[model samples]
Target: MVFSWRKRKPRNGDKKVHHMELEIPRHFICPIALDLMKDPVTISSGMTYDRESIEKWLEEGNFTCPVTNQVLTNFDQIPNHSLRKMIQDWCVENRSHGVERIPTPRIPVSSAEVSEVLFSVTDSKRRLDRCECLNSVHKIKKWGLESERNRRCIVANDAAGVLAAAFDAFASDSVEKNANVLEEILYVMNWMFPLAEAQLLLGSKPSLRCMVWFLKSNDISVKQNSINVLKELTSCDQLYGERLAAIDGVIGILFKFIKDPISPLITKASLMVIYHMVSSPNEKTKAELVEMGLVSLLLESIIESEKSYCERALGVIDKLCETKQGRESAYDNALAMPVLVKKILRVSELATEYSVLAIWKLSKYEEKVLIEALQVGAFQKLLLLIQVGCSGETKEKATELLKLLNPYRPGLECIDSQDFKNIKRSF
Candidate 1:
């Protein structure tokens, strides 16, 4: 017989708590949580615990059984339905004591089921049905959101390439007809990250076209996701970065977002894409970004940004400074030296490092910029950075900068940041 239990609410005049003081059976409690086991499951260690609790433990990279500390050889979780039913029966038997029945949990999605869903998405695309495709894509996103395990399964099943194909196919379709599907495609693709294999799939001219098309999307989410995917791809391989930089007008679109300012998230994503694109060995990529007034926008970002945004903007500037045109543009900006100097030792180690690099590169060859660096107190901060702590490369750059700026120093003695009374210039 199927049984159900519901706690009875007490009348106002009863003045008694309905369910606070009842004693739950020892076996019914989850060992992990020290509470009633709502959805009991047995693991390979021959221990039964609440499903959510055990899954959380495993998800945190634990391989040993929580109770006995035995190493788990098999991670499968078999539902203790019989025990669950018994718990329900006990609840039903104690309804007058205000025990509530445990609800039966739905079975989690299996890998085979994920494959079937992926196949359905492909089949739906072949049949040219928008509703079916959207539904299937949504299913994958749902499972991906359900748990980390499902996301791992989605990644294992090549969801990145499949989703990219779907996105490419639907990118040119009427936005009203395929907008939701495209967004879902990007959403699901996000779950399958470190997309090394998908990088090849998305590196083609057609994929670039799709990304450009998505960037034109009126929906902020579509634009955000599109840029985020590009960031991931360019990060995976510098070859991908070179390919993306080769696309005409792509750099301009990314800069437009920075110039006009979208949300902070999209703005940072766009900066990272620029960082990766210019990070390629190709100097022309960095040159193209500078040609589009990238230096001015990055300076603005640094002056008005929070710590995270400040770090990204400085990183891009540092990359750009590696090129001649980029260095020229930065030297031309009056705010350049002051802003870069101000960021030192203030934002983060990375921010300070990038700031120092930009200063070092820009002032490396120019006497006027070296003086400007000294006037902005760059010399003092560089010394402080070297003494306190920094990456070896940053320390090296700071030391070189100090040597370069020392002759320009008003006196051989340092007075701004620290005592140089006993210090000797190795240079």
Candidate 2:
């Protein structure tokens, strides 16, 4: 491969023969992979290699050179531009042989550039061309995903507020005509979210209300992105959280997402946001969620969800079970106690902890609930759970329930069946 970027002049080109040739030199190949370097880089050991190959070596904890076996003090893989140029030119010359020239890779956006975009995006009154401003912010968002440094740059410069402003601009202009722009803002928000937040600020409540309308957007990605923004704001941005939750139909809309989630992540975010809102410990909020029928939805999620989803589902279930209405909802359902019992040892430790706690609550709040649980064969599962051994907290909860049931031995015997044999010996 030719490493020279200088094109051969016609003075030397005049002597070229009719035949064409493609030749790659040994030094042009990476010693590590023995292949032509795509992005050649030199390590501190003075050994050059393909950037991908050398990075993998360093990541795997190899501090010595692959070729020289010399100790690498810095292990910095500096890009070999000259080698890249040579490879690019060689491919250009070998175009007839099906070799394709690699395009130049973009350098990551710098902190200064991010700062400029933040200033421009936030400076709403500027007479500057609007499209150019949006395009610059878009590039910064793209760069934020490029590298950790770029992400820090964008976050440190207040990407959240920038995105909110962009959202407000396009949304105010014309939602249908400018929806493409709104989607871009959502994408940027999704990337910048769960980032540096002390400097970041959500938009005004009016603009935030506008964001709520996005929940109905037909695009699944847009819906997920909107939920992501709401989740972050509600969890970290206290001012925005309360306002977002106060919007009409917020709980019902989110419940729809939970019931018919576009993706597991959306479902998880919906559950987490609900969990945060319910954590206000407000009697009204808890009652509202219970009134919205979250208990049955959470139960369905538990039965169908995977391990992580099950953990989150049970988490919400545990929270909802704190209210009288929540318990009544759970107890009223025939599947409630039986399904909660099934997850005791079937899912994760977190799930088991919540499941046991829910049962404990039912038993503690009302003795009839405990007897009902026993009548449903909960004692059999509890018996197996304690004997099999689990976390101390789960074991403690189970032990309490068993002690509660020990006095009801005759009731337990009446409840036991051949499917769960030796119920008498369990205690």
* Whole-model lDDT per candidate: 0.81, 0.73
lDDT of prediction 2: 0.73
For candidate 2, what is the TM-score?
A: 0.71
lDDT of 2 by residue, 224-276 (tens): 88788777766774556566677887888888888777788888888887877
lDDT of 1 at 193: 77
Clash pairs of candidate 1? none
Best by the TM-score measure:
1
TM-scores of the models, in the given order?
A: 0.80, 0.71
In Å, residue 350's CA in model 1 sits off its true spot by: 0.7
TM-score of 1: 0.80
- The C-alpha stretches of model 2 lying farther than 4 A from their native spots are 1-37, 42-79, 85-104, 124-132, 144-182, 198-200, 203-207, 237-241, 383-392, 411-427
